[model samples]
Target chain A: MLAAARDAFAERGFEGASIRGIATAAGVDPALVHHYFGTKDQLFLAAVQAPADPEELLPEVLAGGPEELGRNLLGMFLRVWDGPARAGGLALVRSAVGSEWTAKLLREFLVARVLRRVVGTLGYSPAERDARGALVGSQLIGLVMTRYVLKLEPIASASRESLVEAYAPTLQRYLTGDVVLPG
Target chain B: MLAAARDAFAERGFEGASIRGIATAAGVDPALVHHYFGTKDQLFLAAVQAPADPEELLPEVLAGGPEELGRNLLGMFLRVWDGPARAGGLALVRSAVGSEWTAKLLREFLVARVLRRVVGTLGYSPAERDARGALVGSQLIGLVMTRYVLKLEPIASASRESLVEAYAPTLQRYLTGDVVLPG
Candidate 1:
């Protein structure tokens, strides 16, 4: 069922994929899907086997002071990528890259559950918050692509501590520093 | 020849695609492929219809002072993406994402022709140079993915001038600022 869901999502994207279609592909009754997964979003979360549960992990990352938020965020990111959850994260990224549905699902999940929450604490204007969130997203997504997927040298080989130190400052700037956005 | 080469490169990647193979695919003699393209590398450059000639554009980007290097790099990047070259750039990126051969080709091209040149201009240790180059690569690649390929909101809608202002400082930091990488 999960596999079918993944295929459907990858092929059709979020808006186009249907629970009934997934159930039919899985050779299971539609009621079984609803019974097991509750909803399409929930099924996606399960199929992706998300590397981290943002609801559970975000508080731990957010507990520190604003200055250390970048460090904490990156630290958690590295942990998710480097630790036992690495496979799941890699799978999600591969699927996201291959499918617009997966990309949209992942993007919405990150924005609503993670980035928005972090930006909410910072108290910027809506536009500023959106800009900052996107900037932060760019850095994180780039880091993942170059370091993990493409396996670019130096970065792919760098120690966890080195990456955290090098990236945290940039994240800090995006999170709270002065970023000029033209009107 | 170019269309066949593009399809071959996009499907099989650089290492896998051969002059003879391209010729066969195009229903031409292998000698004709050599006659026109001279070499695989030359053929790739022609097929991708690369937006900026690195040799010509790199000097212009690197001529400015270090403080403005990030801005110049991004300015050139945005110009390449926003101008008539947009189609070529988009095709290259899409092919790169679809095939490891294309990714490797793109990576080597960027590193050898562009990033290394920029890093070489700055007198850093070999290790530091590699690290800094990768950092810059991450930001630029991420920006392209979000702004162009995925069409992420806010970033996709941002004006060229606004993106330049917002991203230049981060690029500057990655290029010349103090990036600590533990030994």
Candidate 2:
């Protein structure tokens, strides 16, 4: 079922792929797909094996409050990429670079599941929040590229806590600083 | 010869691929390859179609002085990636994500060809310089991923100068600030 969903999502983006079509491809009822996966969004999370559950992340990350948002967020990013989800995370990132379909899925997942949920609670206009989110995304994605994918030395071996400390301020500024948003 | 070199590089990393091997694959003498390409570094740059020429970059980037390093560097990067080199640069980055061989070639090219030359003039110990280079790399690669590969909006459509203004400080800090070295 998950494989079918993956195929469907891969062929069509999050917007184009339909729940009923994915269900039909999976040889299951639409209702069953819902029962098993909850929604298209949930199905995607399962399909990509995304470990980013806003529910799990919100409280712990927000626990640090906005002041420590960058620190907590970078630590969590390191944990996810460095921990058990590393392989899946790597695969998804790898595929996303090569495939527009995968890139779209990743963008949708990031904006919908991760960025919006986390930053929505903060008091910024939607446009401002998105600008901030994209800025934050640029830094974090670069961290993953250097540390995990490219495996650049010193960075690849740098301790996680050290990375969090080094990078947190950058992310913090993007998330909370008075950035010059693009008009 | 270029095709042969690209194939050899695609199969073997920068260090692993030999001039002899590439020449043999091209059915040409190694001396002939050297005559045409000048050096292995030059050969790889032509093969990868890299737009980053340190000789061209160093004087321009340094003119901004160390304090303006981040702004100048980001501006240069944006110009390189956004100009006529966009297609080749995109291809190289996308391939690197999928192939370790490509990734290694990229790393060698980036470090030996680009990073080392630009940063070598700076006043820092080998370890400290490396740490700075890697941090700067993280942010720059992330900028590429978001603005180009991911096509994440606001960032995707954001003006080049706006991006430079926003990200310069982060790069400046990584390059010139008193970052806690990863000892």
Highest lDDT, which number? 2
- Measured against the true structure, the TM-scores of the candidates, in listed sequence, are 0.78, 0.87
Q: Write the per-residue lDDT of candidate 1 for residues A83-165, one digit (tens) a residue.
A: 88877777776666666767766776566556788877888888888778888888888888787766678888788888899
Which candidate wins on TM-score?
Answer: 2
User: Lowest-lDDT window of 10 residues in candidate 2 chain B?
Assistant: B112-121
Candidate 2 residue-wise lDDT at A51: 56
Give the count of colliding residue pairs in each prediction.
Answer: 1, 0
Per residue, candidate 1 scores C-alpha lDDT tens digits across B19-131 of 98899989999899989988887887887666767667778888788888999999888888888887777677666666676676677666766788888788988878877
Whole-model lDDT, candidate 1?
0.79
- Provide chain B TM-scores across all predictions: 0.74, 0.84
- Candidate 1 collision pairs: A13-A101
DockQ of each: 0.40, 0.67
